[model samples]
Target chain A: MSELTPLNAIGEFALINRLQAGLTLRQPGSVLGIGDDAAIIRPTAGTELVMTTDLLVEGIHFDLSFCPLRHLGYKAVAVNVSDVAAMNALPTQLVVALSVGPRFTVEAVEELYAGLRLACEAYNVDLVGGDTTASRGGLTLAITVLGEAPTGKAVRRSGGKPTDLLCVSGDLGGAFLGLQVLEREKQAFMADPETQPELANYEYVVQRQLRPEARLDIVHELRELGVHPTSMIDVSDGLASEVLHLCAASGTGARVFSEFLPLANPTLEAAAEFNLDPITCALNGGEDYELLFTVPVTDHEKIKNHPDITILGHLTGKEEGTNLITKAGQPVPLKAQGWTSF
Target chain B: MSELTPLNAIGEFALINRLQAGLTLRQPGSVLGIGDDAAIIRPTAGTELVMTTDLLVEGIHFDLSFCPLRHLGYKAVAVNVSDVAAMNALPTQLVVALSVGPRFTVEAVEELYAGLRLACEAYNVDLVGGDTTASRGGLTLAITVLGEAPTGKAVRRSGGKPTDLLCVSGDLGGAFLGLQVLEREKQAFMADPETQPELANYEYVVQRQLRPEARLDIVHELRELGVHPTSMIDVSDGLASEVLHLCAASGTGARVFSEFLPLANPTLEAAAEFNLDPITCALNGGEDYELLFTVPVTDHEKIKNHPDITILGHLTGKEEGTNLITKAGQPVPLKAQGWTSF
Candidate 1:
């Protein structure tokens, strides 16, 4: 193990805060989120309920050598929230079950809760009941989030149409670029104990890696724009992976020109610093937590000039194929490596 | 590490099945309790919801050197359900998260889930959704459960009155004694690997430890009889500890005659064989999963003849103090050593 990547490292709570920061909550139904005994949700009569849960373990979903505990805590909730958001439902309550090794303490727990609370507040969620126990090894966080949509509006990954225009919100590849910077800094810090990490200049890239926000804003914006996605998913396992997911579920294919890919300024700067192509980072980077969906072409003119939203591509025949066009005009196939936790 | 205890050991799914084979589901709302993507639940409207969670980690909560995973899994959910039952509520849903090390296989996860699912079915709860992740070390199981009661009928720990008749459901000390049998068997097996774990003779005691059930039946009976508990709690952290919780929360003290302590016939047999006192086991051993509570004096007639219910004590003014009566007619102070996980 690298000296900088200390083994059996990380107190439980510190890892939590690294994952929760700078998010927004725009739902009125979210009465509570992230830090409490149990979340209390108030759903109108005739409304149904949906709940989902997920768990993340160190040495599995992340390497503390590169991942921070605060970010871990934030990601724990974010991933579950993403699942709820994928259902196209508004989230209201979350319960966390955390198991920490002796490597944790009161301070560490507070840090984790701080990040959890931040995420809950951003998503207009309430942190309800949870479990806390001591683990014999690396940190493990299990979160169950509760969501409520109107009586019959809970969207599934299986809901899409043949002519839906595949749309994506915000930019991708920024988080992947951010990870590159962190990994390099970690390597430099490991090479010499006295070396100071020069991360000040890569603020945006670092934020992408350390604190990726959930795309609830798009969920809300679409509702207000009166444009509902035929189907949707958040990019956690990578963009290509998510695209295939929408296609496979909707039984359709899609085509996108690489020139239209969204790239944050920081992404280009960071990729340049590392002497790497920015498009690759944008295409395959995971943890962006951005929304990927399909809307009818009629909705295209409705959001064509929108600043953050992008018309990445459009759905097609199942046999037509899912491919990305290069700016150099070469066609490239899209494949999802899928996140390997094993 | 006891040879029989299976130190750092996780059972394959088959063994887990064998372990859960002994318990039977006893509730009607237990739909799709254990083996599915997520447990499904159905609760009638106008019911108040009560939820609680508990997490158990190896080394911290149990020493596999002595504790078994099958038992641990069952205990984890049973204890939390007991909390809901203590409030005179019916458990409805459960979500389980487990983190495993590389030494385990899919079979092990299945076994753990089997135990968890068994408890859910036994208590009429749906499995709902949960997370499964990899752990860097020993087994970690975290479970959160949801329960329900009539909007205004859910009993709380703070409802006892000065003259309430304190009661306990079922015999105590068997589960505690069962734990002792397991510990002793572990020691004996460590001395001789060929031992078949002579627990057949101590079936009652061992079952209490390995497959304890929540007293949900008592809660239902009370409702049917039109009797409501003034205050309640499960006998999880020892009877003494639970009595104190009731007293402190109800703003009163308890006075009980030692002769009124209830112990199973099997518990007495095992106590004699182990050279132990059954009353001590009843008083201090945790994990009984039985309800310890108080009812208004006028309602005593409602449950007095109830087969499974036992009258153990009564509530009094703070000036009376919390006391335990000895078989010898002497008052004794109560001591609680809650399942020490620290």
Candidate 2:
């Protein structure tokens, strides 16, 4: 019970003013940031601009009952930045449009913005402009991130060649497993209000679910190691789905080695506890925010020793079809059981 | 009733495929469009990139009962484009993110996208990227527009000076009056379903409300006339509000002559029919999507004879305060009763 000001009391202008007061423009290209009809930025010459947008609807993409507003805000920006990284680009700026419900107080909005600002700082991106309005149903966040890559340097999903080594950054299945843990806790709490849910044991997995970071570090490291991914896409829709996307875009097929699929220890332990297959989770669990990419076979040696990079498989001709080779030496057609909002 | 396919029937990816099938990328700088994690574009050298985003929530921004889905889609793009035009920039691309509800069908989404494509063609801005997801409540659209202006050529609201002649493109009060008429008709229809709405006489105003176009033509005309506006803003939230915005941004005051305010005859007639003051409607009516700007006194002759342009008044020192010179020879302080979503 603390005194809190409702958003309606101060009006839209004052709310905007409060939200923008702490923003500091640090991007060199940002000529004008906020406080205008539009934001102005000067994109550097000889660089291609990479842009992506993502929309997260309440009750569809997240459940506020268990999800913190700050984490929601962070995830929104991180997901967009992940898209930027998928293009082999460095995110420079972002514009967020939010539709907040009447139930949200000024303090709640401030908390959300604080997370957004923190993500901006972490990603080295500036908050350029956005629009905020009232929502009749639930809160919605739509974020558009602007990034830059040197001319002819952007790695597209269509660039993978046959026999290219497919690689993935960091471990997978943790986020999806983390979500399961959170949902279970939520259900348990609902059944008995006095019961305190135990989440400390699932800290690593839960954090992965709540505050997944974009794999910008992998993008930077690849560049530093003199390696450019032949094809790239962020793993937002599970490894199996993303592998298929890269293959389809490149007019090829892929053979993913089940043994090589990276799964965190916590993810495996949680999968066993839940009576789920860790390998299945690794293949089809989404929201890892990791980079799934392909590199020419000749450059594989340069990336093989990298602790964060895992070589998962190789591309094949179209006739070969997309398949996941089991540890038992059987080939099964890869199925894309990615999340469907519908 | 005709058979229709629900959105969930085809799922998110297939629906996206259907919607993007007809999109043709016409921008030279567009290196990538859709189907990837992010879109890529090569911004022209030495030009500032102008970015803006707007969120339109159903029930909050529009009434689905009367507002056609097609017009909602069109207005979403046009309003974002209007912001780019206000910055004195040419809109080059847009990314639209939409959250639809379960009630939407594949055909309904197609209709919405058809309208979006039509607006993209009309505005000559490429549809580069977007996100599509499901919502639990009403449909929501968040659009981000990217435009470009030559270095140091983008106009800002803070550049106005004292004695600058304020001008507006097209007539005002029509859109607001149109909303009023639509609401009245809706009430009447609710009262008696058998009675049809008598909207033939209010067609012009109704169209203004339903499909208001952004004044990009005025931006081009001013450029062609060799007149760079000292300050400019789109009249999205009424004349009084926008006038006050320019004043506050520029640290100056403004005098808007009530007699010189642009009002369509149809709007005036509608106001009389509703027993409302025409002048008040002209001053407080929002969503005209027209351009309100100021030009140096020396360039007045170049724009005075333009058929769509109307010179209202002039800016004054901050101490003079923003006011409207009444037809009765008395000046009244301008009030910003702008639309508040809160």
Report the poorest 10 consecutive residues by lDDT, candidate 1 chain A: A31-40
Candidate 2 Cα errors over 4 Å, as ranges: none
Native contacts recovered, each model: 0.38, 0.93
Rate residue A43 of model 1 by lDDT: 45
Candidate 2 lDDT over B1-342, as tens digits, reads 888999889998998899999899888888889989889999887788899999999988999889888998899999999999999999998999999998988988888898899999999999989899999988999999999888889999999999999999999999999999999999999999987988999998999999989888988988899999999999999989999999999999988899999888999899999999988887888999999899999998999899999999999999999999999978899999889899
For model 1, fnat equals 0.38
The digit string of per-residue lDDT tens for model 1 on A1-342 reads: 323322134432234333333333344443333222222234445555556777788776766776666777787778778777766676777777787666665556666777787788777776655666666676888887766666556565556676777778889888888878887888898999688888899888888777877777777888888887788877877788888877887888888778888898888888898898887777777878788888888898888887889988788888878888777867687887645444
Question: What does candidate 1's lDDT look like per residue over B1-342, in tens digits?
Answer: 422322134332233334335434343443323322223233456765566667777777666665556666777788778777876777877777777676666555555667776677677666655655556687777777767677667776778998899999888889878878888888899999998677888889787876778888888888889888888888876788788878877889888777888888999999898888888888888778788888889987888899888888799897788889777777776666455443
Report the poorest 10 consecutive residues by lDDT, candidate 2 chain B.
B276-285
DockQ class, candidate 1: acceptable
Best by lDDT: 2
Where does model 1 exceed 4 Å of error?
Answer: A1-43, A62-72, A275-277, A325-333, B1-43, B62-76
